[model samples]
Target: METFKIEGNVPLKGEITPQGAKNEALQILCAVLLTPEVVTINNIPDIIDVNKLISLLKNLGVKVTKIAKGSYTFQADAINMEYLESEAFKKEGSSLRGSIMIVGPLLARFGKGYIPKPGGDKIGRRRLDTHFEGLINLGAKFRYNKEDHFYGVESPRLKGATMLLDEASVTGTANIVMAAVLAEGKSAIYNAACEPYLQQLCKMLNRMGAKITGIGSNLLEIEGVTALNGCEHTILPDMIEIGSWIGLAAMTRSEITIKNVSWENLGVIPGTFRKLGITLEQKGDDIYIPAHTDGYEIQNYIDGSILTISDAPWPGFTPDLLSIVLVVATQARGSVLIHQKMFESRLFFVDKLIDMGAKIILCDPHRAVVIGHDFKSQLKATTMSSPDIRAGISLLIAALSAKGTSTIQNIEQIYRGYENIEERLKSLGAKIVSE
Candidate 1:
């Protein structure tokens, strides 16, 4: 129930570092359960969702120790299998969508995994079939309690098999990969998600004695290992957060330098922002975004058709940044269409931006046409509530560039992803206060 009271029309300046990848942290943390040895993880973002998962791990008897800020050591030496059937677990496990991932490692090592219906951003229908079906294909028996809304998977031993996923779902692929790494034989996953986060998981698993090939492609070959040894791993900087900072710099006419951005792994994010005519420089692994005092312009397609920005699997534009893109487009010089293909309800937050004086046409649940105001008309600040993590940050960006004070409610959603966001913005001279 926290609120962000922001004074708008304030330009920000200074250097800010993006937090560790939240998505990767989720998958990586769950992988800790695959071994009983000590796993040291660096650059862990202290966000709500990640902390919740850590707490869940502690409840399940994993020994978690804080090494320092953004670092932790976890050893799942004595897990309480009985806790998985408890009411406390049902409530705790259902609160986080990431909790679904622990099932994979649990089922791999202990032969049984149970989870309550996981919950996350209500952006759209996020189905669990992908995670469960992948485990089932790996020789696990799946059962569901319709009345209690719980899922369980168990197997004496898992045998590897090739799987062609229905969709390249990231978390689904992570679940299956975790299970397959300890499975009886070699496994090939086609049409898998090859996002940088997933690649990190594969590489980390390899360091732990799991044989996984094709790190950066859709086809992953995993050879089951007898046992995995723990290793220290450092997470990459969050690309989505980096993209958000780029959009914030443009919309608020701020000059900002984002440090340690992992340039090579960004994959089309910089190019997508350039298509909006935003000027960003690469300065040795850092992204320097200059102030857009004169307003940026959107570039059309080569054939002169309107520029259409859409989300696809990795190596394409990320759906998570489409909200930021839509908000940034509001102050650009031309029009662009934003197609949010993965989630139907994510674009609904555009109505709040429309009220802030952005010229946006919500064509449908999946697409919106945004006509840039070119900074000729400054957005007027207004009261708004954050809908999800992405839309929440997008709204904060819009509010920062607005003409007056704006109040944003339900900012807890924002904290679920971004760590210490208000302080980070404040260090860049943004006038934001949380209450």
Candidate 2:
């Protein structure tokens, strides 16, 4: 039960590097199972969820070696098939949401994919129907055991087919793509998730001899290959963390430089923050955010209505950053509505903000209206427990901008995504201590 004691009212000023994308790492690591040869990966975030996934790979008899900090090589030549059905596996695989993605590569190579009920942030009903339904659409048999609470899919050989996904679910698309790459014949996936992570996955697979077209679009075309070879991949900088840095800079009136943020792939993140009247300067690959010394304000709609910052699929605003946006809005000069469309319960953490003297109204499970204090009213310190990863970091940003000392417990949730967060924040002049 570690806690973060963050002293508030100090402007954070320094340069910080965003870690490798956790969401991207999950898919790339799972893709390691697609080949028996060594798959080397760089820029791996040493986060709890990633380590748990790596441990799960080790349990499956994949040869994993740490070549360097944030780098690894995986060879899945000797998979232990028996472990997939073991009681220990069921519990371990169910511990993290990313574990479900393993089933896709496993099914592609070994003809069988089984996962126990996967666990993650209790944000809403994150259904596995998309993954299974996509697999089933590709001629795989699916089964769910109520007694053990397990999901399984198997096929002697996957036969490619054209399918339209119900939703452009990120992991679902990745799972299906992994399976489809090794499938026999041609496969076409329409309405697929075109996130940068997914695009990177497609590119890596292509490098490994999988013929995939439509790299950055929703319509993906894959020609089934008999086998895949090993390839090296470097993950993109985490856009979520980049957004967090932007929020922290504004909330604390800090002038900070986020280094090597992969500007081209940021897709509307910078513009979204700019809409909130935050100034950002791009230097080569880095983003320089100056202190909001004049205070920030929300932009209204063209019709003069209150502005709404909502989440959508990639190329649109990311749902992951809506929490950060909400926290940043608290100190702005105007009001904005946060609409979380994908996950329902993510906005529930606004209640905790209210307790800290924030003018936030929980409109529902999916929406919140934040009345920015314009730095006229400083947030009072309070003790709170973290509900999830994104919300925890958002609260940390809020705490740093607050007027007094704040204690945030259950920091383990924060560590699941952000690597060495307290250390990184401290280097950026944020007074956060882990105890």
Candidate 3:
């Protein structure tokens, strides 16, 4: 129940480094269960969801040791399989969305994997069918308990098969890839998610002695191996956080430098922000966003139609940053339409921004049209509650650019993704305090 009291209308300056990819950390941590040897991981983000997964690993008897601030070593040699069936596990596993990933590595090494319906942001209907259906295609028997909303998968030995995914779900693809690496035969997955985080997982698995090809494409081929070995891996900087920083710089008229952003892997994020007329420079591996001293203007379509920003699979705009884009658009010089195709309820948070004096039209659950104030009309400060992780940060950015003090409740949602967000913002001269 933490609250953030942010003083608005202050410009931020300084350099901030993005945390390790949160999504990649989830998959890599689960991959540790695929081997009994020690696996070393670097650049781990100390966030709530990632930490919960690490704790779940410890409770399941994985030997975890802290090597440094953002590094850890994991060895799963003496896992207690019986712990998976306990009530404590059900409660603990249900608290994190990333917990669903553990089932794949567990099913690959052990004979069984069970999990309660994993919890996360209540943005929309996040179905588990993608994860379970992919596992079933890999020769695992699936069972469910409707009364308790629990799922279980078990197999004596998994034999790989060619399958086409219904959707390019990132976590689903990661789960299936983990299972297929140790399967008995060659496997081919078409229409797979090729996001950087998934690419990191596939590459890390290759380093650990699992054969996988098509690192950055939709078609993935895996040659089943008998077992995997431990390997050291480093996660990419979180692109979502980098995008957030870019939006924050634009909205608040701040000049900020984001260090070590993994530029080549950003995949259209920079281009998307540039379309909004924000000036960002590439200084080596860093992104330097100059203050929008005169405010920014959105680009219109070639045919003079309104600019539309929508979420698609990787290599396209990410859905996670659409919230930031919407918030940034509020202060731009022109109008743009934000279409959130993946989740229905994510755009609902726009109502809070509307209260802050942003001209927004919530067309439906999936789309919204925002007419930029162009800094002519500053958003009036207001009280709000964070609905989800991305929306929480979006609101925080809006609060920073608004005219007065704003109180945002339920900041715990913000901590689930961003690592030490308030402290990082404070270092950049953002007037934010958590209580």
Candidate 4:
């Protein structure tokens, strides 16, 4: 129920450190349930979703201890699998999309997994068909209560098999990989999502004695091990958060540097933003964003025209961040089209932008054409509520660049990903106060 009160038109300055990847941390936390060994994970973000997942893990009897501010040693030695059928489990499991991942490890370790329909941003129809299909191929028997939308999986001995995911879903790929790591035989996954988050999960599993090859490619071969041992690993810096900071700096004409950005893992993100004419300098592992004394220009196509930014699977522009990019495009000096093919309802926020005097054409539910007029900051600050994680960040960007003050309600949605966001932005000279 928290909200952010922001005084707009202030150029953010100073340096900020990126937090650990929320997506990666979720999978790693659940993977700990597969073994009783002490799993030491570093750089875990203090985000709402992670807190919720940790609470769920605790309820399942995992002994979680904080070794440092952002580090934890998880021991699932006494984890009780019966909690998977509890009402608390159902409520928490249905609260976040990442909860579905627990089904894989739980089923593999305990021979059964129960989960309710997972909830997340209502951008579009995010089906769990790929997840269930992959697990079924690995010898899992699924039972669903259609009336209640609850699902259960059981298999005495999960035997790995060849899995060709119908689509390259990020969470789906991670679920399959977790289940396959402890299965009975080698599992080959083709057409998988090879995002950095998934790669991080694979690496952690390997460190725990899981044999996984093709780390950065779609074709992954996982050799199921008899048991995985405890290992210490650090999560990667969140690329999406780095992208958000880049967009905020560009929109507010701020000079900021994001530290510890995994430069190599950020494929296509830098290039995608370069289309907006934002130049980034990489000094070792850090990214430097100069003060926008001169605003950015949108790049046009071949002979002379506006360009378009769209989303796809791995190695493509991340769908989760397209909303942030769209808001940034509004401040540019040219026209650009944003095609959100993955989510039909994501473009619904364009109405709010249009109300702020942004010239946007909602071509449909899946696309929007923004003609950047660089309007003299006519945005009249209004009271709005955040809808999702990425959209919430976009609204923050929009509010920060507006003419007057704006209040964004339901900031808990933003906190579900970004850690101490208001404090972080405040350190960068953003006039944002949370209450």
Q: Estimate each model's TM-score.
A: 0.99, 0.99, 0.99, 0.98
Candidate 3 residues 263-297, lDDT tens each?
99999999999999999999999999988899999
The residue pairs in collision within model 4 are none
lDDT of 4 by residue, 9-96 (tens): 8878888889999988998898998889999999999999999989889998999999998899999998777788778788888998
For residues 318-433, write the lDDT of model 1, one tens digit per residue. Answer: 99999999999999999999999999999999999999999999999999999999999999999999999999999999999999999999999999999999999999999999
For model 3 the local lDDT of residue 240 reads 98
Superior candidate under lDDT, 1 versus 4: 1
Q: What TM-score does candidate 1 get on C-alpha atoms?
A: 0.99
In model 2, what is the error at residue 173, expressed in angstroms? 0.2
TM-score of 4: 0.98
Candidate 1 ranges with C-alpha deviation above 4 Å: none
Task: In candidate 2, list every pair of residues with a backbone clash.
Answer: none
Clashes of 4: 0
CA displacement after TM-score superposition, residue 412 of candidate 2 (Å): 0.5
RMSD of each: 0.6, 0.7, 0.6, 1.2
- Give the Cα lDDT of each candidate: 0.96, 0.93, 0.96, 0.89
Q: Which ten residues in a row have the lowest lDDT in candidate 3?
A: 126-135
Worst 10 residues of 1 by lDDT: 125-134
